[model samples]
Target: MAPIQFQVGEKYFTANTKTLTEGSAWFKSLFSGSDKLVLKEDGTIFIDRDGDLFAIVLRYLRSQKVPVFYNKIYGHNHLLYDQLLTEARFYQISYLVYYLENRFYAGYVASVKVEILGLDHGVDVPLPDRDDDTDVQYYPQWCRKEVYVCPRRVAVHRGNPGGCGRECRAAQGDRPLEYEDEWVLKTTEIRTQTILKHNMDSVKP
Candidate 1:
């Protein structure tokens, strides 16, 4: 049977489904001469220097396609991922939110101190438990869209936030720090209480 053909438009340029043939021309137009996407073995795609993969992801998101990719290469970290996901939710990208929720539920990434050791460690935190208490001391705070590490510790080993960006080394010289114990994920109960308090405070007599 012949396939259905739909008129190409700017919207098609951002389509992310596997069945992306009808709008090939329009999709090609969105890309600059130097812009290109490379598929990785992990099922993620990388864009050229001039092309922002986030835009592609957003396009797919608009088309209801799930976009899953971590952009914390050099110094970016899970905090950035969380922040991005938050923005994704704010913009009403259910697909991206679903993807982020899965990552959070499946524990594809680690919290902060507890590295992605395995599925067991990932399950330890649990999705609902994330909002309990954020252990900022060790895990670094994910507030205000930036990962701020303490300037008193050092990244003696890999993934350690020592001297890569912040000055959290000299602040804690040679002190065997216990960042792991500070895993403070927020709890649902606390969140509910805070919300209720805010509502009451905003109420007029």
Candidate 2:
């Protein structure tokens, strides 16, 4: 059988009608009848959509697998996944849309709390010269004011919950210089409390 030729934007693509129809309901409906299609003079169907994204969509139709967005050299390209989601929605590919949404966008809200605890001494106070206290000095006691507490909201992706702690620490900023001293007895605690906002599985296609 002759392959179906498509012109998406400035690019051209060809695929077997069986693959397109099986992968997408939109394509199945589009080619439902023998006389339904209105091909251009060049014998190719024209689709007013992104050509580059259509290539990815076509690849998925052939392979029936999600495209790899991450590599050792460039890491994960989240923007590419987002673009694929858009293209999948446009093509009415339910499985691709479901996979993309659950793998990346589906996540819970987390409340991150970072606390710094230790004793911190303030500047020494000098006592006034008196008959019996001329050489005396006064030092204020360590107080709770020295403790640091930072609260933040981090979106925890279902694929990488461990990354939430790293994001929380970064958002809390650097620790105090005094805490860096070996002699200073300080403790840093990072806590993450997860809150489920909604279930992505229950979302309708």
Candidate 3:
């Protein structure tokens, strides 16, 4: 059978009827038997949609596979994926729509790094332990109190000398504190991270 010719936007595309019908319910109804499809004067059916994205849809229909839309330097081509998603929904391609939506949620964090700036030892405070049922308690004599330098706040952690039985409690301040010799200093860093699930591989086609 002759391929169906389509003129979408300012581009042209050609696909066999079998591939189109199998990929989209919209296409299946459009090409259903005995119904004559109107065509432009040049014999190509004109579609009021993006031609470039339609080409990607056609390729997926033919191969049942999609290329990885990622770049090392510029990161994932989110714009392209968004465009393809719109095209797939317009075409009523259920599988393609599912695939693209899953890909959107399949982001993974490639790497992470942390840096330590400075350290200071603060004045030791001695307290008697008559522990109430609180989540944290510090033993007497050997307990060390440390203040953390944060971006906009300070956090104080009270722990035993051996770094055990430590509880981190946030201490809000007007501004970031500088490293001081009298204060046992640690840096508190807050970072936003994206965690990838182990089942991410299931989304692969």
Residue-wise C-alpha lDDT for candidate 3, range 86-157, written one tens digit per residue = 998988888778878887444453433233223223534333232221122222233245433443322432
* Candidate 3 residue-pair clash tally: 3
lDDT to native, each model:
0.37, 0.60, 0.59
Query: What's the candidate order when arranged by decreasing TM-score?
Result: 3, 2, 1
> Compared to the true structure, candidate 2 yields what TM-score?
0.47
Task: Give me the runs in candidate 1 sitting further than 4 Å from their true place.
Answer: 1-56, 62-65, 70-77, 102-205
RMSD of each predicted structure: 22.4, 22.4, 17.1
Encode model 2's per-residue lDDT on 1-205: one tens digit a residue: 6887789888999899999989798788888874546678888788888999899899879877566564323445789889888988878898888878886433332222233333234333333334311122233342232322332443343223344466556765675312111223223222222233333332334
* Alpha carbon RMSD to native, model 3: 17.1
**Candidate with the larger TM-score of 1 and 3:** 3
Candidate 2 segments whose C-alpha is farther than 4 A from its true place:
33-38, 104-205
Name the candidate that leads on TM-score: 3
Which one wins by TM-score: 2 or 3?
A: 3
**TM per candidate:** 0.21, 0.47, 0.49
Q: Give the winner by lDDT: 2 or 3.
A: 2
lDDT of 3 at 29: 80
Q: Please give the lDDT score at residue 118 for candidate 1.
A: 20
